[model samples]
Target chain A: MGAPLTTRGNAPKQDRSRATRRRLLQSAVACLAERGWTGSTVAVVAEHAGVTRGAAQHHFPTREDLFTAAVEYVAEERSAVVRDLPRPAGVREAVEAVVGLYTGELFRAALQLWVAASNEPQLAPRVVALEARIGRETHRMAVRLLDADESAPGVRETVQGLLDMARGLGLANLLTDDGARRERVVAQWAAVVEAALRG
Target chain B: MGAPLTTRGNAPKQDRSRATRRRLLQSAVACLAERGWTGSTVAVVAEHAGVTRGAAQHHFPTREDLFTAAVEYVAEERSAVVRDLPRPAGVREAVEAVVGLYTGELFRAALQLWVAASNEPQLAPRVVALEARIGRETHRMAVRLLDADESAPGVRETVQGLLDMARGLGLANLLTDDGARRERVVAQWAAVVEAALRG
Candidate 1:
């Protein structure tokens, strides 16, 4: 469902327009989560938002635009959660923070996006770009927390490896439904990445 | 497209039966790959296979059955490839073998299955179970290659971490199309895992 918008013509209802856009984006997220990428369409998004398809289209002209916006929305939400997180004192804290964030609530929407992108070529590139941004930002966080120089041999790859494990473990936990085991696995992950960086 | 199969009463020929199944499975792969899980129906599978819908239904009684067989077939193919690979002499070789194979061709098919499973609740549990089996098997292989006991302080997590990274990097590469960089990343991954195990 597309969010209701208060356009220039409806100056007094500008807040309504902003509200509509927000509703539409939220509806799109629900639709994507429910239907996967290919199954998600403008019509469905509109229906989900409880708005007319025309209204949905009025808010977002193309499905691609909606999808791109939704991804950005997800990324922004994730970034917001981690933004104020305390900087890790060392490798363990950094690893724990990264793993914890990834394995927690912050990951649900992004995982949906990841699954969607896997099958849709048109969607894959954009999702990949978004992920690349996440990777770069996360690496920066790791560098600050680990006190590693970027130019140091294997520093980037070391951090990348940690991110990779976080993702892998996330998928594994989702698939396996072993919450306790996943926690153990994640803690173990923190240990390995910590060990790797020490050397 | 569904395969052209002979009736149970009388098979067309042994080789022809094999060919029919092969064609049907290939069509299923193509259809699923092109359309995502929801888009790939038995009728579409049949059409893609150049066979009749009736024939497809006759050979595979249910769409779930057909999809399950298709997944198993792909898993078997991957298992075969891994089996045929020469035994690694030590930790480094084993990690390299697993990472290289995973990040290459095997990763694409696996990602498709992962994406497909997300849309099919019926398929998700089974797919998840199969993936867990694979994870455990890979972990076992790592334990053997590294000559580490399960009781070893960090062996299990380290092995799990390596497998996790292999999968994470594999999926990331498939989505991002950063093949060359992924290769380097996997190589670096192997180095890190080897280092962890050694420590």
Candidate 2:
């Protein structure tokens, strides 16, 4: 929006340029979630997005540039969703909504990056910093959406524990379809959160 | 302990053979934690354990064999610990102990393998199966240790949620030392578990 990331000077092609960039990002996230880091080559992602490799490269000059942008794009989308939400009707509904954020392609993609970064010297610091920022922002968003009083004893930690549980469920779900079990656990956490916050 | 894994039919060398295998397994886990899957070669592990590559190969012919055996050995050791643990005086102690188990080298190594397995077709299914079995065993052990009654509403999910929270804490700790925050979160989870199980 500021100056169009992919191109310049060509006003007529601006919207199409933006659209292409968006598609590349979406494809990167989806590819990462489905195929993990090893399968997520820039060429592969461009092909998956129905774009030429040159166009993808034009938008993101390197693999790290592409995937990191992909994660950032999705995370921005999540923050927007959290901000625009209708303020959930109850504690259980709010808990479910918060947990829902971690179960999506964004969380899965970030997780893949985290794993890749653990041994990658260049990626490690970038990922640690990015994820820490995301963690803090998401915590702030969750606290707002839950109407939590962090000033209360243990309230801050209680909120963090909920997010941690949500992350754990997300990790566990990566390998198997633990839907029914996750649903039960989500409900249990809502009760716990409500009680913990009340005290 | 049974028939010795690294060597066979060498009665006089059996003890040394067992010791070599044990060293290899421990070194593999440590290497995986420190260097990740990409650096955890049999040669490197052998070197780290002060053994020859030939000796490491004698124990585990393949990288996959070495890593899988390392995970299995550590998991078996964990099961033994659970079986041998004296009953905790209360929920807080039990929760701390369970959380402690997820914070060690084994969890770190397993996480690296999980990231590796996610992208590896040959290793994916085997890791999945192994992890599922381990998850179930850990769940059973936690239930026994927590003295949880699964027949009660949400009790099983509560215990699972606690473990999920522990896993999340482990993941969080991987990138940075979130010790102070994690301590508070663990204390909060202990309280939640006590409350949830009481019902």
Candidate 3:
């Protein structure tokens, strides 16, 4: 399949541009996780990505744009993974799966953005909307993976409670490894979740 | 009963100093809750407290000192409230008390600082230590209030789970009222806590 001369000429350049943007976004996320909002300025992220300031600015004109997009980009990736995940066979596995979603680098990055967004007027609305969308989707995923009946009274709240607990666990992990204690907590939750669903 | 001239002269001045300090700390918390860490500068807090910048600085030499002290001051007050609270009659009431700790303006003020502290190097260690102490005391208070027997297997994790769930609920309430949903979640948690403790 032969393409027109103009199309062929532009393909490599467009690919290069896309690759650069990806690098910047990924670098932004890493920077946010390690240094937080105060340290993850556009120039720092640009240097981290090995891209010119001009190129980063061209891709994302504002600090808000770059950071929010960075979180959103990674969030979308996570969402896709959750969607493609195989259905859990039991409550324990399902609990593990949902808890797994909130305990890593991406969560750290998002947490930084969230704190900054709460204070930054320009950044607040976008981050809030993005988070609300993610919250709804994650709840749906939990319901689906758990194979629980939401039609029953008290079921939705139980599921929401689990999600909130997972988030708090994630918050705890930010300060310390919290892995050992977290496992205990998760195991306990798995039991609570099963009994709630069954009853 | 007559006091010396020096002691009499100093007492009112010291009273004024203590009053000024109290006003500043309260103002700092109010600012943190409404405007977050960024907007709640030393100057802004001074203005809010109806104190001079000099007086504010006299009490707290740096921004970190002021904000951390603000949170700590409020936290100590809250701790007093917790310590003095009558023991709950049952799991449901105990859960309500614990969840109630994290859902109000104090929690919001503390949250803003927690996020800010996670990023600010100077603020991190103090805030982390403060939170750890608070976490321990709160945990102990919860144990006492719930009448939990920690000797039982999984009992500790169950209590910790309740705490983390309460924090997650607090986080959720930051952006939205989440009242109706929160009531249901807390109701379900009441049942869960009762079973976990009984088992």
Candidate 4:
């Protein structure tokens, strides 16, 4: 896979510092996805970024610092995708757009980070917070689209349910080799969310 | 709090070996929940179970074996709870029963185990398998309740979606502090499931 912003080798020559920071985060994500959290280290991350360990340290003083940056980067990327959605033509379009964001590559990266974070006591809180932020943002969008209020009975639950289904779908998709099944799951999710909003 | 079956102090007087094994698994779960996957250790688990390091090793020849047994134990406990439900009187009851199991102690323990396993490369495949097995079982139960086959349009998707909602509810409940809020989430889950089944 191409290095994310964290790869120093891919950074512009004019922006050494910014490039180094990006490379570190990108490298951290790669290390986490390929070798898992336990196997990830500053030296490895620096090597992955094609930079010296000192450069990685300059960006992130500790492994935890690097992990936090990586997770934040991933979360921001995911948030950007969701926030960039063009105004939906209608409720149907909103549902489809939400599904698309949740099932996209950015989401896949987030899921990889999420799986790693869940097992990390220090990182779990940050991961949970990140997800909660996303949930609140997405729910706001859903509420806006559905013309529903926060106090409406079952509205929050339905939104949370939809988000959860999307996450579960991503996880299942990652673990399984079935494309047709993944599509079917997404279609089903869209239907369920549509029904909830319609109600 | 407890040792995997091989741990010493918690072993049964009637069957020392069986007791040791039970203690180790319990200890492992408690240690995992408390310290997380990375921070947990065989020595800590042994200490938690009130056993010596030697006893812990005698019972579980390796860390992988110990973790695997713990995974199996937790999975079996969860399966027993869900599988024990008698035929539901109706769709509503099935929905409630399923939702209840998701929010129940068994699922909570399983969730903790799952979070811990997510970080362990060697443990992840086993966790994925266990999760798939549970999902399939849930699907079968839903199929019987819905009176539909896998090929039936929306049947598989609906079943899978409901399971996702239940799981999401469980995690949400775990994260929230308010007891009343937790109850509301459960009610909302039941409501959504009932609505879907009605359609």
Tell me which residue pairs clash in candidate 2: none
Score every model by TM-score.
0.81, 0.89, 0.91, 0.73
lDDT of 2 by residue, A29-51 (tens): 99998888877999999999999
Classified by CAPRI criteria, candidate 4 counts as: acceptable
Model 3 regions lying over 4 Å from their true place: A1-6, A88-90, B1-6
- Residue pairs with backbone atoms closer than 3 Å in model 3 (clashes): none
* TM-score of the A chain in model 4: 0.74
The residue ranges of model 2 lying beyond 4 angstroms of the native Cα positions read A1-9, B1-9
Error of 2 at A67 (Å): 1.8
Candidate 2 per-residue lDDT over residues B1-199, each given as its tens digit: 6667555577658788999999999899999988888778888999999999998998898899999889888888889988898978889888888888788889999988887887677887878888988899889888888988999888888889899888888888887778898888888888888987985
Where model 4 places Cα greater than 4 Å from the true spot, the runs are A1-14, A87-131, A140-153, B1-14, B81-125, B138-153, B171-185
lDDT computed for candidate 3: 0.87
Clash numbers, per candidate:
13, 0, 0, 21
User: DockQ, in order, for the candidates?
Assistant: 0.44, 0.59, 0.56, 0.29
Tens-digit per-residue lDDT, A31-131, candidate 4: 77556566778898899899998878877887878876785686576566656666677655665555555554455445555545645667677767776
What is the overall TM-score of model 3 with all chains considered together?
A: 0.91
CA lDDT of A68 in candidate 4? Answer: 63
Better structure of 2 and 3 per lDDT: 3
**Which tens-of-lDDT digit does each residue in B13-78 have in candidate 3?**
899999999999999999998888878899999999999999999999999999989988988888
How much is B157 displaced in model 1, in angstroms?
1.7
Candidate 2 falls in which docking quality class?
medium
Question: Which candidate leads the pack in DockQ?
Answer: 2
